[model samples]
Target: MDLMAMIENAMTSPVIYLAILALATLDAFLPFLPSESVVIAAAVFAVSGIPSLPLIIVLAALGAFVGDHIGYLIGRLLRERRPGGRLIRAADRIAPHLHRRGGALIIAGRFVPGGRTAIVTASGATGYPLTRFTFFTAIAAVTWAGYSGLIGYLGGVAFESNSSLGLVVGLGLALSITALGELVRYVSRRRAAATGAG
Candidate 1:
């Protein structure tokens, strides 16, 4: 069967929620998992009044939050293993800014493919504060889950006759959002560098 058919079949299973959770969790450490796509599919199904939207959001958010912590723990463990090094020093240089504007990074990363794992892993490796990281990541998790779901819901609703088109629109919008966020970050960094030089 095709992608939509497969998704529909998967939804029939009672443990689909568990699958979503597991995929989201693994996606935190392993960027290969298509958690975002699964989430969008689930949201699309929800729009068709098949599955519940809130459940998808909750599962996605919780999975994201816990996975981030797992990355943090991995970093903390690595920190314990090594002392001061060039890598640590470099991370330290960026730590303060990460702590200051970390929320934006976390939120933006959620939408970017392969970004969630990288951001959280880097944050942990650099020993960013657990409390602050948790606070910001939580917000990012909720926002990402909601925003992703909403995007899929809108697409599915708008293109009910052609799900393929809906999926394309949803994925396109997500990528566009990621691109815009990266652009903003790039501009902000350039402005900061210029100010520092001045």
Candidate 2:
């Protein structure tokens, strides 16, 4: 059997769900985790009936929620130990904005590499309440996972007959979507800054 077929065979129920979940959780603590890619891959596999879309979403969301909490806890611990540190300073600066727009920011941050980890961590460092953080993060994680999974599913459908085309298009679209989000965030921040300066 070819590599993909072999992989699909090995992608038993536990392997598929557990692997995605682990990666998703790890990415929360380490922004460089590439959990999004894995989720996309899982979605791609789901296209062939190798896995289930709902299962992928479930595992991804679970990992994201749990991982973010760990990151928050770590930030809280560090905050207690590090007086006037960078995290604390950043938290102070963003705390007001986060307080006013925590849910929106969390949702947007999920698409921005490194942004979610930093923001979530900072929130904890600044004593952002666990209850509020969980509420916002839970929502963000679900939305982010669903969006990513859909992207992969669509890409897989497009490449159903052409693997290379599907991969190229899938990756391209994913990157494009992320870029768009970043652009919007950049412009919004700039506009807000400009208004503040006025």
Candidate 3:
């Protein structure tokens, strides 16, 4: 079988759920992996009722939650090792802001491509409260999973006649959303900087 055929077969198989869980979990620290793409693809296939949509959302959220903690732990470990490390220094500089608006940053960063890892890791490095981090990260994971899955589900519904086209639409929508988010963040930062200068 060709690559696409093999992937389709796996998506239809019972193991697809496990695959989703694994990919989402790994993608937290390893942003290079295409966990979002996997989730989107599975969601696209879910329109046919092979893999359950609810299960996809739940597993994806759970995986993300677990993976986010791993990033936090890594940051904590790094902080313990190197008091003079650049990451620790950066975390120190942002510690006050993190305490004030950490939850918002944690939640928003989850949706950003690599922002999730950096923010969560910095949170840990800065010794942000565990309870607060857990609470916000939970929200982030669930919302992120829901948003991604829903986008794919919508694309699938729109292009039910063509699954391939549905996948393309889903991916395109995901990319567009990510890009929009980055644009907003950029604009917000620039405005904040300008205001600070003035």
Candidate 4:
């Protein structure tokens, strides 16, 4: 079937919660999955009373945190073995800025595609102190989960009110995600340039 029908079917499925948790985990590490869609679907399912809002939030947060930690460990291991690895080298350039403005970066990164993964990798590659990384990452995880969940919940409400509402809200969210990604890229490039110039 088409995308909307598939989503509607998934929303009613008994295994949707499991699928959502899995999606959240994969999305965190893979960086390419449409994770936002998964979370929104979970919220939509919540409207049907299959998955509770609190449960969705908890599962989403746990899955995201675990996935990020895994990514971080991978980055650390890779950097330890190959200090000059391309990814590590790029991460190294931003390590200092990450160190200085980690909290803000982590929070903002949550909204940008590929940013959460990049931040986790940079944290490990840069050897950021574990305690600090954990503290900030926890904050970011909570913020990200809550924000995404809220969007999904809102989407569900809109879908319930009117079919056109879903389309409008989904399109708006998509645009917001794209704009945020572009903004993050611009900021990163500017920071890199300034660091070079200085």
Q: Which has the greatest TM-score?
A: 3
> What clash count goes with each model?
0, 0, 0, 0
Taking every candidate in turn, the Cα RMSD to the unseen true structure, in Å, is 2.6, 2.3, 1.3, 3.2
With candidate 1 superimposed using the best TM-score fit, by how many Å does residue 21's alpha carbon deviate from the native?
Answer: 1.1
Q: Which scores greater on TM-score, model 3 or model 4?
A: 3
> Given candidate 3, what's the lDDT at residue 34?
83
Error of 4 at 176 (Å): 1.9
Q: What is the lDDT of candidate 4?
A: 0.76
Candidate 2 lDDT? 0.82
**Candidate 2, clashing residue pairs?**
none
User: Clash pairs of candidate 3?
Assistant: none
Q: How far does residue 108 in candidate 4 sit from its true spot (Å)?
A: 1.6
Residue 115 CA displacement from its true place in model 3, Å: 0.5
Error of 3 at 149 (Å): 0.9
Tens digits of lDDT, candidate 1, 1-198: 888777677754557678778887788889888887777876766766767778888998899888889977776666677648654565577677777778788777776777777678768877777888899899988898888788877878888888778877877777787789889878999999999999
Better of 2 and 4 by TM-score: 2
- Estimate the TM-score for candidate 1: 0.84
Give the higher-lDDT candidate: 2 or 3: 3
